[model samples]
Target chain A: MPTKTVAGVTVDVNDEGFFTDPSQWTEEMAPELAREEGIDSLTDPHWTVIRFMRKEQAEKGTGPTVRGLGKTSGVTVKELYQLFPKGPAKIAARVSGIPKPRGCI
Target chain B: MNSQIGEQAATAGQPDPIEKVSVIISQGSLEGVYPGLIMANGARAEGIEANLFFTFFGLDVIHAKRHEHIKVASVGNPGMHMATWLGGVPGMSSVMTHMMQKQIAELDIPSIPEFVEMISDTGAGMYACKASVDLFKMEKSDLIDQVQDIITVGEFYDIAAGGHIIFT
Candidate 1:
């Protein structure tokens, strides 16, 4: 396991920088992690998704799929791409302090 | 240090993730179409650009009337585990297709049309083969609205340049 320091706290992470123990996450660390994922700022829509991801991870033990996010999250799929370019689900999961979603779509 | 060696060292050890994918779907069976759709959708989910080129029988996937009603082939498919003779019986293909649709529904996978919409919403390109359209005597209005264009094999190659090409 690797470790990363964010928001003045050190935590265990996987080789890809996803948190190994999501319990160690705090809201304060979100903006910093988002920055690490190349998101320079956390807007209202971004927080909406991050909060939704955290809650979904707590119940499901994994982040939602892209389709699931589009169906459930208030943010549309196109908006998600606007918020998190490149890989929306993967980057959002990393910022939300959850494991990568295992679904193929 | 030589410039050649420096360039090699700079490019050699860096990880290069797949940035794009062009999936060619040449089969029209339910099983065949789903694999290509799944792979193309998966590529977009991973932040990779994806283009789906539907040719030959695969054009049924985007056909306005046939896209929503693709059936699983019961005969000549070993994966079904039934005798080939039994698979040829009337209504067997429908039964198998219904069963497969139920299973796919249980997994929360969308129907073909819905899946196509989802992929389009993700900005993945969808194309129909011009040669197939001509052979089938189909018009532009025959395809779903999601299809960006009807292109030739050469055009597909031009768009797929520098990306992974998957034939299914």
Candidate 2:
């Protein structure tokens, strides 16, 4: 049994060993970040889009395009600003637990 | 261009001089599963300690339900038709992905689950992207068995920074 703790979230992994909540997710669950940072990371539209990306990634294991994710979630890119003034990559990085992707870093 | 890909141990703090392979598995789909899976597997057969990471769509290769159902492309993908006998049209990536999947499959291949098993059996490193896990709302329960760790892209790079990185 292997276990990792991140941001007060304890992830207990069994012998097969899977991460319950990927440890990198800290101060950035979108929802959690908003509550603590007073920055509303997961706005309605952003939530819609991120949830969609998450679903796609979970089922497919790949990230979705910002435009594609927006289209599916019924939100315009303009609405996304309220959540992540930093743009999609930041939100994607925060949500994906990726700490910003190749270009951003 | 008679260059043959090769590998040799890189001295600490020095880059690997050989053309080593780093495999990123991004699709959890049946069709998208093989490239990363088998390529990592094949690299290992050649004695390379490949780094296999599963991200976004590629994570399906390591998930429970869809691992074995992973399939070869058959549609608008232009994958089914033979541009040449037993291979795809020249210079197209889809063809290569398709052919590689088949070649690996015919070699008494295993499903994505089985492939991961073999990867472990061969001592290759395996990781899953953390951001994708959070985005996908996947509990650790969502991942397949044998994933060594869940890391952010930064963490993955901390490992990948040393070797050749490949995205499939």
Candidate 2 global CA lDDT score = 0.57
lDDT of candidate 1 over A61-104, digit per residue (tens): 98898888988999988888789877788889999998888897
Model 2 docking category: incorrect
Candidate 2 residue-wise lDDT, A34-72, digit = tens: 444245445565566656655665665554443344345
Chain B alone: TM-score in each candidate? 0.94, 0.69
Q: Give stretches of model 1 more than 4 Å off.
A: B1-15
Error of 2 at B157 (Å): 0.7
Taking the tens digit of each residue's C-alpha lDDT, what string does model 2 give over B73-108? 443455456444344334444545566667765654
Steric overlap count per candidate: 0, 21
Question: Lowest-scoring 10 consecutive residues by lDDT in candidate 2 chain A?
Answer: A96-105
Give the Å error, residue A72, model 2.
50
Q: Spell out the clash pairs found in candidate 1.
A: none
Query: CAPRI band of model 1?
Result: medium
